[model samples]
Target: MVVDLQARLRDALAGSDVDELVELGCDLADAGRQEQALACFQRAVDLGQDWIWFNVANTLRELDRPTEAVTAYQRAIAAGQSDAWLNLAHVLDSLGDLAGAMEAYRAAGQAGGQPEGHVQLAHLLHQQGEPQRAQAALAPALQRGYLPAVALAARWRWENTRESADPVLEQQLRAGAGVDGSARADLAELLIATGRREQAREQLQLGAKLGQRECWLPLGNLLAGDDLSAEPGQEQEVDGAEVDKAGAEEAYRAGIAAGDEWCHHNLALLLLQRGDVRAAEEHLLAGAAAGDELAQLAWQDLHQQD
Candidate 1:
């Protein structure tokens, strides 16, 4: 089906102007013909469609040709596509040019000043050890009601300032999570940090049901015998019950079906414990291909043992 679609796109591109070529290139890229898409985008660029540089750069990035992507992205900015600078930051970051990426993100922030852009800028700033600036950057985004920004701000407060999340912030997150499923994962994190494991588990389950890919890992962790509660201000043994293996297995499979890489790693561990070595290896390979470092280590260990 994809092959036929690509062939049709090629036929269309044969007589296409710059705009038509870009459209066809977009279709090809969406269809997973990354190299063909780059070719079409390059043809548009050759025709002096400077605006098409952004399309060419995106396709190049997808093809793992980041150097060419950087050049094309620069051309895009030169052509007055200021928004291309935001995407350029991503490519630069992938190329390990953190300084360049930060500058590009700053440029993007100055131009658009959107919540999402500020959030990205803040994260990079935080990573660069500029916590003060990061906090300042997050203020606008948090006030804009960007759910992720709220969670990030809470995390910054908890981690950097050695302070607990303020009650108002907690309440705000809880209210947002109640109506917006996407916010549930972040709410669960806050709840977990505050020793409200039961509430956190409930939020995680709801998040998973809502199809949040990241919710599965923490949910799986909670299901894997981490549900014990300690008495306040004491180290005491709370009885740990065996987890429901079947339910966990189901959750793992659901996450795998959703294309979550971490799920493959978690599911592989369960399969290995159950002596299903072959299936465990299969999942480990999938996870490794998806760039899970732990999965790659596990796969190597298995081969070494053999």
Candidate 2:
């Protein structure tokens, strides 16, 4: 049955207070009531709250209605809220309009625009395979202490050189760990690189507990290896110590819930090892749908089986 959002709104929106409506909309959205929140935002806009269009756009985005979100974001931009450009750029990127996203990101970083736009711009450049440009664009974000930029730059260095992270970058990641889960994950990786398996587990555990669901990926691996271990009952190194298949499954599921597609691939591997071929296939498809390369390859290979 559909929710009677208007009736619910009538209980709290009896006043003409724009701020109240916006606050209620935010509260509703936080509770996953996007349609009700959308109504609240739209009502605020009808009451001359032009700035509320940004909230409407955000709600629309959360509702997976990108076309309407883009329109609402455009209206907010037209009303002189340049920060809407940042969100609009993200929507364009999600819609696969890379060039448009690039242009919109540029607009979002200009005067009166969102400063974090530069960080996202750098991220997009990286996605488009322009590493040099991504690094260059990231400079400003780094200077501003943006955790994603710091993490990306550090990752690039480690990926290209196969050496330990630079001391300064390592320190930055540590400092940012309190606020960014990725920072904790990176720090754990640095520890893992140095053969500090136990410390790495500690970092991953804390990060996962702090609501950094992505940490579950590494944590799960550190807990259970690909061997499944039910036969030989052991692997080696981090997870080699003790193969907690149940814990690994839990971690993978949590990571999947947290939007890390790669967890599906790992979880599929575990399921396959358990002789749950159908379950493995299901997770492979889910991972493929989320653009996980390993999952896509595994799915293709599985489909080609004799």
Best candidate per lDDT, number? 2
Which residues of candidate 2, in runs, are more than 4 Å off?
1-52, 55-65, 225-246, 271-306
Residue-wise lDDT of candidate 1 within 95-191, one digit each (tens)? Answer: 8898898788777767746466777889998888898998888788777788767767655554544333568766656655644444566667677
* Predicted candidate 2 versus true structure: per-residue lDDT over 5-50, tens digit per residue: 4555776577788877887788788778898899899998998889
| Candidate 1 local lDDT, residue 105 | 79
* 10 residues in a row with least lDDT, candidate 2: 231-240
Q: How far is each candidate from the true structure, as Cα RMSD in Å?
A: 6.5, 4.8
Displacement of residue 106 (Cα, Å) in model 1 is 1.1
- The Cα error of candidate 2 at residue 92, in Å, is 2.2
